[model samples]
Target: MNRFDTDLIIAGGGLAGATLALALARVVPSLRVTVVETFPLSADALPEHYQPSYDARSTALAWGSRLIFEELGLWPRLSEHATPIRQIHVSDRGHFGATRLNAGDHGQEALGYVADNRWMGLCLMRELLETGVQWQAPAEVVDMTPETEGVRVALKRGTETWSLSAQCLVVADGGRSGLREALGFQTRNHSYGQNALIANVSTGESHRFTAFERFTDAGPMALLPHGTTTRAGHQSALVWTLTDEALDEVLALSDPQKCQRLQERFGWRLGRFTRIGECSHYPLKLTTVDEAVRPGVALVGNAAHALHPVAGQGFNLALRGLMTLVEQLRQAVEQGQSLGDLQVLGRYQRLHRQDWQQTVQFSDSLIRIFGDAPAPVAAARDAGLVGLDLLPGAKRWFARKAMGLGGRRAVISKPGVARREPAGHE
Candidate 1:
């Protein structure tokens, strides 16, 4: 009989979980893997919006992340729905500080890309169906026991209960992961006293594939280009941050009133904010676990570190972490080492520490520097922006970080693997 039910059991079937599964399947074709998710994974089983990853919010995929997807052969499906960002415009509102980063300056085709979260989820779900990894949805890990050899998982699905064992368990659940908490993992929390208001908007002018990040005393607001609207005008995804009171006030406003407020804040750069689709709000906080790995378990994605949306670093960082983990896991498997051994997982942890620290610190710094309204801090931040614009080398460094470059990289695909370009790319 087999020593375990599967070689790896991933809890949470979101992007990180699914991507890890796909990567593992490619690296270790013989590796047995299973994904357990609480939300409906089947398209016909639930309303489209009801999918766990179906939030209206969009993800700004760093250029490096795009490469990872391409290496995994999932980029072709995602590229169709992605909107490329050729340039980024950073400015401090009501201040004389601004900077712009262009893809051409870095010899790249795009600075980054913006993709609808719902579309990404659907694409990932479709890929999961075609993969060799086992998929179980509307299911959850009710209990897990860590041992020297492996982790035993007790999953609950509807009225049925199943017991399984895995050499390693990966937790990719979101910020409020019950399984993570149940395992007694402690987290450090920093609430920003702010909320992000997100929505799709139609602007009077074309976006021209430019992304704008304007920092105000209230908070930082971003208008990410989402390609053209049905009316042939420009459309952008709005991510506006506000304090608690302002968030409440904005949420209570009518559509036209909200548009007017957005216009006042964003100015006439994109002309007028003519229309806005359904709006959603998410509380902003930075949460990080005390440790991301145990003897038989590891944490990935938000389960490891839930970052502020500032700079759009959360998901990109998670992808980097996932890649590192997979690389380390591959080493363990090749060396015939036990996957659940702390020594094996420890290597993975050590390799990922720098990347995690740098990303977390970078994200937190942006939130601290821009989310506050203190006079001295605001002035200093504005001057910093001015300095960044003046220094080409510094600007390139910042852009590279934003593009998810630097640091140690994991091998995503075979050295000479080629991929198909998605439709709509110029």
Candidate 2:
């Protein structure tokens, strides 16, 4: 038998990594977990309370994700700042086709919720302070080596460097993860030849808790209802897709000029764009790794896969994958198996591969089918949108997929509850 310093070591303390740490603490209390992050994790390092910023970046949490956080007992806090997406209106610019999905029709409170990234991180960190998980932050994993028993990782904090061994290593780093490349994980990248300009815009009319997805000859754009502590009705987070040349031109325009351009593209919907906040842009691409796990290593979150934002499935998909990994780890503990056992890790990959494939296909197809289509294809898609509105079953299926409930979901037991082992394990 071999002994390891820590049962699991997670690199990256962002949303995915922190959520994984909390899940492990709840499901397998006895497992020793350590999280290494480049950012500071001390109490003094985090804000005492969240202050809404006009330009603060945000993420869309599908309905399934709300349930996951509820199980973790963090949803109550997360909800305080989250704006429910009561309805979603999708349309093709310059076409007569449009469709709407109402939460009431589906018997759900909201299809999803939009939350500020900083606030969500704060909520997770506050809860994690009470857990026994160890944290090494204001630090990073400088090097890693696969050993017979586990993985040996070297950490760098300030000018000091030290080594530690863990039975398993989980990488939750962002999309541009240097550690993943260092570990020799081959990736497939498909550049969409476009960039997304993200910002917060205020409208003359209230957003009314509605999200919008509009497609045009140039690209697809999404406007998710966003609210701040001081103002809760007229603001929305905008994700506007544009070509490389267009992106540079838009970024160079004055604030008023930018608003005018947005209004022209988006049309009279939401009245006129009254104001636009600071804007930032990133190149759009589809990045994936065929295999996200090894004997003692696993990748979660953006490190594992990064998809187009057209569907807002990036974080939601990553959350589901992490929860599934947690379920697999729980089973390994009950069976007296090594935490890094390849059989255990392989099962997690196999179970989640389907969801990954479906989501990637869904997002990619949306870009290809609707983005810069010819007259005939555009006409067909517009007609299809109208048909979708009239077909209840098809609309329902589309709604479910958008809400992140179309695939297998991992059942995570709440704190103090006994989790049943997955079936067929006997």
| C-alpha TM-score for every candidate | 0.92, 0.96
**By lDDT, who's the top model here?**
2
* lDDT tens per residue, model 1, 1-426: 888889899999887888888888776667799999898755574243432222356889989888888877789978877888888999988888788999999888888898877777777777666768997788999878986599899999989998898999998887889989888889999998889998888888888899999888788899988853222238888899999899989889998999999998888999988888888888998898878899899988999888878788888888878888887777777789878789988888888878878888888888777765778877887888989988998998899888888545566433235434322121
TM-score of 2: 0.96
For each candidate, the alpha-carbon lDDT, in order, equals 0.82, 0.89
- Per-residue error for 103 in candidate 1, Å, reads 0.6
lDDT, residue 236, model 2: 97
lDDT of 2 at 142: 72
